[model samples]
Target: MSTALVLTHSVTAAEPSADGAPFGLAWGPITKVPRPFKAEHEANLTALFYPHGWDPANGPATAEVILVICRDEGLQQVVWVGLPMSGEALARTRRAIHAEGVRRYGEPGVGGTADSEVWPGGRALLASREAADGNRELVMTAVGPGYAACSETHHAETGHPAGTHMADLIGTGSP
Candidate 1:
């Protein structure tokens, strides 16, 4: 039941733009997303994605793009799950993802596993991690007052710290 918690610590990056959208999807409202997705909702989080699957240009073909929406706050995160692969594919995907992050958000911040890297941005936090089993994943979470508001609401309701859950919610580990 491991879940990937959203990074709540203070960041120097500017606040997320209200209109900013990652993965061609905007950052507010679930209705804005297209249909034909396998969907589920629990508490303040709603997870959905096209069952046919959408793959990032630089990502692996097996990857599933999961859209995470925070109730009331709209689309808060975009998750890309790359199914387990051989060493070479894993390494290549990791490098490509990291390079994309660097190009978009510049150098990453401290505190990343050898298999992971995180880039803080004015609009969101972009991160990528590779599981021990060679599952590569990339995550982007919206930042700013809207996110803080949602976090506070989530904490008040769950009695636990607010953060995104990957394993239990989306059925994966160390996303």
Candidate 2:
């Protein structure tokens, strides 16, 4: 994260200013002026590398998505970037993810899904599995939508209890 924050300005000037007061799309960092971000954007990067049984030390054998929520208007955020593997590529990622899910969460709870009413009016799908291997358990969320420019994936925990987290993205019950 850089100190520079990109913003849309209403000022219709060709350049900043002749007096060189200081003004443009870049505002550096907000050190004093209280311009609070009303909403929240979470990445859950703790499980970013591998929530699956795979060993992170073995290397980066996984994929991920960086959801860039651009606009936050309370109850919902309209614009965003959702990236994940898809089609033949998704199949490869899911195989590895599924193997870990079944190994850690045991069989049956591992599955996937595709939806028409995906976020932002498009189709999307995800295949993830969870196991009772540890406090973090092990879950893999690999998804991409027609609306998004790319595919994305996640390996994380149930956060609360083992069975509390539902794989709603998969349209299936938890393992």
Candidate 3:
């Protein structure tokens, strides 16, 4: 099969805060060469998401991107990021992303899943499923304000803008 690289991002309403920091999670750009997938790729990606300990049923929200890196050796590697999203508006954003995936790639081979954790303030951590193909899928969820903090941390740690990193990860040049 011909390999494909996919990346998606969704914007949610920023949460109101007296602190006035831009509220929303942003994953740093990651880079990967395009590749096709087999069943193992999907399984591996799913396994990665579960370890973060999030459950989507609890009302946390997420945004994610899936990357499939195919090799001549017949193995595909999938990578993803889980960002927190919560509440009704964030949930709607997640659903919209799912719909977009279905429209573009047809039915995903796997359904979305999530794991949760607690962060500072009232915010919670989440990892929700995003998109999937025969080979890979992505899941993410995070609180609005908390998301922004995480994004900042990611940028500081990586030394490059998240959007730029994402572009490199998916080989899409730029977002």
RMSD of each: 7.0, 20.0, 15.9
TM-score per candidate, chains pooled: 0.65, 0.24, 0.27
Worst 10 residues of 2 by lDDT: 72-81
Question: In candidate 2, which residue ranges exceed 4 Å CA deviation?
Answer: 1-82, 110-175
Off by over 4 Å in 3: 1-8, 11-70, 73-78, 107-175
Each prediction's Cα lDDT score? 0.49, 0.23, 0.30
Instruction: Kindly report which residue pairs in candidate 1 clash with one another.
Output: 29-74
Give lDDT: candidate 2, residue 164: 18
lDDT order, best first, reads: 1, 3, 2
Best by lDDT: 1
Q: What would the per-residue lDDT of candidate 3 be over residues 81-100, giving only the tens digit for each residue? A: 42433466446764565454
Can you tell me which runs of candidate 1 are displaced by over 4 Å?
Answer: 1-19, 52-60, 111-114, 121-145, 162-164, 167-175
Residue 169 shift from truth in candidate 3, angstroms = 18
Per-residue accuracy of model 1 over 11-95 as CA lDDT, tens digit each: 1111233355444455766565666336766668666654323322123243345556678887766544445455686566556
Error of 2 at 153 (Å): 29
- Between prediction 1 and prediction 3, the one with superior lDDT is 1
What shift in Å separates residue 81 of candidate 3 from its native position after superposition?
Answer: 2.7
